[model samples]
Target: MSAVQGLIPQPSGLDREDDVLTAEGLTKTFGTRTVVDGLSLRVGAGEILGFLGPNGAGKSTAIAMLTGILPPDRGAVTIDGLPLGGRTARTAKSRIGVVPQEIALYPSLTARQNLRFFAGVQGLRGAARAERVDWALEVTGLTDRAADTVSSYSGGMQRRLNIAAGLLHRPKLVFLDEPTVGVDAQSRGLIFETVLRLRRELGMSVVYTSHYMPEVEQLCDRIVIIDRGRLLAEGTRDELVAPLGDGLLRWELPAGAPEAVRRELAAHGRVESEDTPGGTALVITAHDLARALRAVTDLAVRHRLPLTGLRLDRPDLESLFLHLTGRAIRDGS
Candidate 1:
């Protein structure tokens, strides 16, 4: 059994209900501008829900509201059926672990000391505290370095320790905001493995927010895309990408490629043109890949437009983001 599995008992009875978190009509505004508007979401137990949005998309505001750090202008949030505020809110908050985008830790403290302090804050004490501190170290692969001060650790090691600190008390749900930021490939892989173990071994629910498309695509069971204070789409990757037809076919043409050629390619599928450093590029969302390729090649030959470069790409989360938000996720960030 994993360290998490060995530490926490299996949840039963009412805890088995799938919906671990529910937010209804959440809205947040600052001054004259509304940041998060009428946002609602649901995350089931043991599920990793990817929260995606471009910069200034109100992703931060929405997370604050959901975590009860900021009160929403309108809406209600409940964790494990416990509403936000009053005694119930405390109870609800106690069951949550939040690992922020920035590392929140005492640089002077050793890894074990940090976990012990955080665990105490969560009400773990005596033998329980010691056990949890040990478990956090073991699960995060920091057991050997438990005595070393956090300031001496590398960026990735500090990030791992941050996660270990949050898991000290073994909260039922976790909010990981860009946890893998600034880490190397090995550390990123370790973080991914740890997250997978959280759900697989301990049945913990996770709310993951990141600008990286591939991480969301690989880790999340379902994804929600939000932009300009509104939700654009929410579903599994396959479900969201299905409506864009098949894959994308892209061609590079000499600058000022004839408008007639553009129109002709549009006849094949949905076409969008952009001026690039090399030349003008035409992208076609193809329903029939074979037919679209043949038509484009034949047209290029007839028009005497040399095909500088050509590539066919399968539909993915990045494509879906571009289609829905009208811009690349990285560009906005």
Candidate 2:
């Protein structure tokens, strides 16, 4: 199968007034099991949106429905205000490119050959097909090795070729599913550059999904997190992390904290009791670290509580993920 499968090519102009893609109340069920339940999101033109979910979060199922590869039991997908299925589906798909998690290429074929094959799949013909093939090679930095067979290329080169295969027609929106997996740092960095270029140079929108937290934090304009097939959160990094508080202040009390001390600290922040090897500790989450620390110290001194140990933690995406889903973003659920 082709690495990236898409429909008829259309004009490259993007509609800036409306979102590039929007899925409303998407639901999918297989027999008695439901993998995706009312999942919905939007992608703006020239924006890179990060889609994050733990394993078995129905992300793949949602993507299939959004791409028109699978039918949704309930819900609708619109691309540039056109419904994603039925008569307008072809036009809607023309704006999309997909770089799948797996490397999609025929090992025996040369890089150029692989691109030509996929370009044909995208309905390019004659001079247009040849031009697009060259453009894809140049964009992916594979022109120098275009004639080399896929099996002879390094892992990074193959990944770049796989990406190039999906983008032959200069799609307006691309869905990149873990494009950097198993790639070297150089290739990964190159992939980042390519994604950024697609947006800067072509005004393309991107939906990026990866288990790597740093990649999503570094690239996406907004982030959407889902778990158990349900939408849990969506927003910019600061927006999502804000509600979790600014930082965590942990204080180990040589003797268990008194109820009055806990109550006094609660006025400053949310306090939780944690069992530690040394003893019980009070972990407080607050927006202002300096004020929270001073409050803790004052209360401890007033209540005659001895502090055995102390630690502080800043809030970040990983902490937000754990706070919401309680599961680290792993490959398998």
Candidate 3:
């Protein structure tokens, strides 16, 4: 089995017809800087949409606008066919759940207590609230540990409880922001199963944000990538990676090798070189991997130069992301 298959169940081919959530021309600005610009997307019923961007990509700002937590400078959000503002704000808010990146559970409270509190906040009361609390606990696989203090639970358990808190009201749409940040492998697997079951059994729609590429590739029905708060690309895994071609060829050579080698390899494809721990790494992007490999091999044999390492990697989301957004590390919002 592939690495992704081991992490997530195969797609269930859920029929997602009408959209449960839609955002149009969403724009947000802080002082002179426009954080999110003309951002727009939609989520279909029972569909999982992968929301992606690098750090400081305005993704959080866009999400805030989508959830009605922060008002967009200009845009409209419709939830379940209702505008997510004014008289319908309460109704629209109730139909969606937000699982923030940070754990929102009270460490001092028991898991059950936390659920009961959030349930009440959602206007759930009496036996209805009790029933929902029980349902949330069961859905998150925390029934056995409902009475335990959240402070005592493992990081993964706390993460699950955080998810349960958002689920008490059984919203039609759920936004999960990096739901598996710090957890053991077992917990991550369980979280994946829980998310899949939500869509499979309850037909819930989800907008998932994660820095982990494999999770997004395995879990999302469609993907939307943003940078600087603007849409860069949106498509399925194959469609998104197709533009970059079949694969990349990387060769590790001595740091001070003659410039002639670099110039020669450039003829085969788009060649780029950068410093690496192994040595100076030469990366080639080409439409045809076989043709590029043949040219690279002939050049290497003719030169009779020692190669530290060489690898041919299939095109993937990570490559596409760096290609679109550049490789510079982003530290601020």
Candidate 4:
């Protein structure tokens, strides 16, 4: 019998050789609670996997297990074809870089000083260390401030440097755990550009975990969503949200539109749900907002009510999340 035929099906085998990482039935528990439960995932070379979930949905715990910071209570994991166990995972971790959600740089250390320290830890020295530090500074656009302490840098600058630090050794895989949080728009754009450049130029496998739906829509080739410690869904953004393509267009009927006003409006579009304090938010499947707007306005005029808000909302990640979980994407409960 084949090795995988006897054991659990390996997620990595879905791809050809050069699969960067895989997790099969990974589970982690604390006390009576299981943080990560039987989660299986795979990322091939040059693939960017976007991982997203509600808060406390085992995103961090699963990442910890995958990267060797925490042990799985059951199942198996591998990085760069090496089993994630014993000292093997530690050695494998050395070849992979992690940009954690929290900044790992020393506040008192200059950018160059911080890079040098990390270079030493990664077994880089002499000319290679200096070259890497210089290259990182240049790429992160911190060449002018390489001598300044991290405490002196702006939040965006610090984040850029944080990414540069992750790239010093050019690991085969990089996991970014919400690296864009708290960054300004410009910084966010820069980080996005830098991440894309890495995938385009160096063919690195990036596993990005974030709740920011738009970023995932823009950057990821495939997105795997987990909720309640289990895989909820996986596919391209279109594949996952395709059902929503036939979704509703929302509008707010100006205040004081009597209960009967909804009935009149129903002739044009379906009313999915409404909030009284905020006016009526009617939903119509696959309908154009412009036409809905005309109908809503005509009804409001007939009823002598005010016109409130109008929106054309497609079924994006947020809607898909709500569809699957019965609540907002940000709402864990």
Candidate 5:
């Protein structure tokens, strides 16, 4: 019943349950260009907040601010109730982990060595460090290859090692930026499986950023969509998908349609796509796809333009993202 009780599943390996982090009015800029505008978001204990946006849309900038890697020109970010504006940020960051888009490891070092170095940097040493190191290697399925040089490891193995390094500290909040980017299918599945295990075992609160929509759709507990340096919306899959206006009704019209006929068809739906070879594909969002289809059919017959194709698109996260951004997730931000 608490505000923080937002679908957090009961899990093991968590010591004390607590809200992991929050960001309010978070903003950043360089000269005249603002990369991340004022934005507010929340990540609960043991929750994964999927951060989604296109290129240049400030996804990375927001991550930088949230992790304290880059100071914000405005607003604030806090972790474990520690303010992001000062020394508290540093201390707070020690309890957090980051899996960068690029694998963060020494190419010449073995996976175990790299993990050990990070654990040491986190101030872990001796028995505790060794325990954590072995646990992380095992969890990420890198134990057998732990002695392999990072440069000699396959891309997928290297990625697993990168995550292993992050887990060595057992951070309360982990920032995963494109962690599975460019990895093979098997490795990607392992990465997601590892995330699930971590969430259950550690009750770890995580922030994930990725261009892969299906991955986000499947893995994240919730999503925050941003575009052009500003937040478009934030909520769980249903909450965000619910307000995507309506389902899509696409109708393919005959070729070389005149303006008057086009205008008539346009009344039934928005002209979403068109091609001379493929005719005009019109899209109208409506709760009743059937009724909308009938209306379009009337228009087609009235104008004598061929109504060749039609389909109903159910509302979904991908559709939601597209509705807000006016572009596909893969489109440039």
Candidate 6:
């Protein structure tokens, strides 16, 4: 039998539960600083959970605790009803596959050779090993180039191969940390397709972390936002953003925009000004874009101030992140 046939358990028979992985009050500390402070979240079976946080928000620390790489100072992690640590730690670890942010392959080796090495570590041998290597190559769309050196593969191919290595044992849950980072558009799309396949075809739960807001917006069924090691919000995109009310209307004005104009814009809603490459931008939170646009245009015309540009940005994950953390996700990164 092929390695995928032997190693990959039939997902059709597996129980699909709402909570496949749960972390309750997970805390971690380093010397004097508590990195991950009382974190908690849940991932549903066959669901893509977007794990979001600013850099240094203890995301890495929290992930380490959940993956069994590091024990939490307080709190607990349960995977597939198996608690982490003690007799069940190994079993719990077995249920998870982690695709780290870094490339874990040896550039000198062929893609097939890398798979063989990882599969061997997982205890597959002989024909089983060969079958799994082939399966991984095929699933990652690298079968034709399986013989090629890792050094020759594009950034995206290398990333897909990284994911394939993680799936050798067919774990029920996967942790994908910035899987699409540093890859081209085509590679990003391919990675997305591969992840979707894991959920749709194999019924695997995924916890995906990324700085690219749109990727999470597109791929995740639900999102969990964290900052300073605390859970800020968790829900579908609409649920979290809807409470923040309507979107933002931004007006780009010349550097010396009149103070009167700024004060006038604030009367419509919460107005924030920042220096941009183009000019000074006034971002106004508005319930009605049409009225806000008319008001701004009228004010600009009355003041005879040059209006450089106007843009209406609908509420999105990025906006939600900003609303919750008071910082742009990218800026935090």
lDDT of 1 by residue, 1-333 (tens): 212112222222223357888888889889999999988888899999999888878888999988889989898888988988767998898888899989999999998988888998888999999999998888888899999999999999999999988887688899999999889999999999899999998999999988788999999998888888887777787776765567778899887778887787777777877677877888887888788899888988888877658878678888777756666775655
Q: State each model's CA lDDT, in order.
A: 0.83, 0.83, 0.83, 0.78, 0.77, 0.84
For model 6, residues 1-333, the per-residue Cα lDDT tens digits are 211112222112123356789888888888999888988788888999999988878888899998999999999999999998889999999999999999999999999999999999998999999998898888778899999999999889999999999999889899999999999999999899999999988999999999999999899998888788887777787776664447778788886767888887777767767687856888787767677888988988897866668877778888767756667776655
Which residue ranges in model 6 land beyond 4 Å of their true spot? 1-17, 249-284, 296-312
Top candidate on TM-score is: 1
Residue pair clashes in candidate 1: none
Alpha carbon lDDT at 263, candidate 6: 85
TM-score for each prediction? 0.84, 0.83, 0.83, 0.78, 0.83, 0.82
List, residue by residue over 7-36, the lDDT tens digit for candidate 5.
222122212336687777778888898888
Model 5 is weakest, by summed lDDT over 10 consecutive residues, at: 1-10
Q: What TM-score would you give candidate 5 relative to the actual structure?
A: 0.83
Look at candidate 1 and tell me the lDDT of residue 198.
Answer: 92
Query: Per-residue lDDT for 186-271 in model 2, tens only?
Result: 99899999889889999989999998988899999989888878777777877777765777777888655577878887877777
Candidate 5 steric clashes:
0
Candidate 4 residue lDDT tens string, 279-321: 5565554445456667767876777765546656666887666
Better of 1 and 4 by lDDT: 1
Candidate 3 least-lDDT 10 residues: 1-10
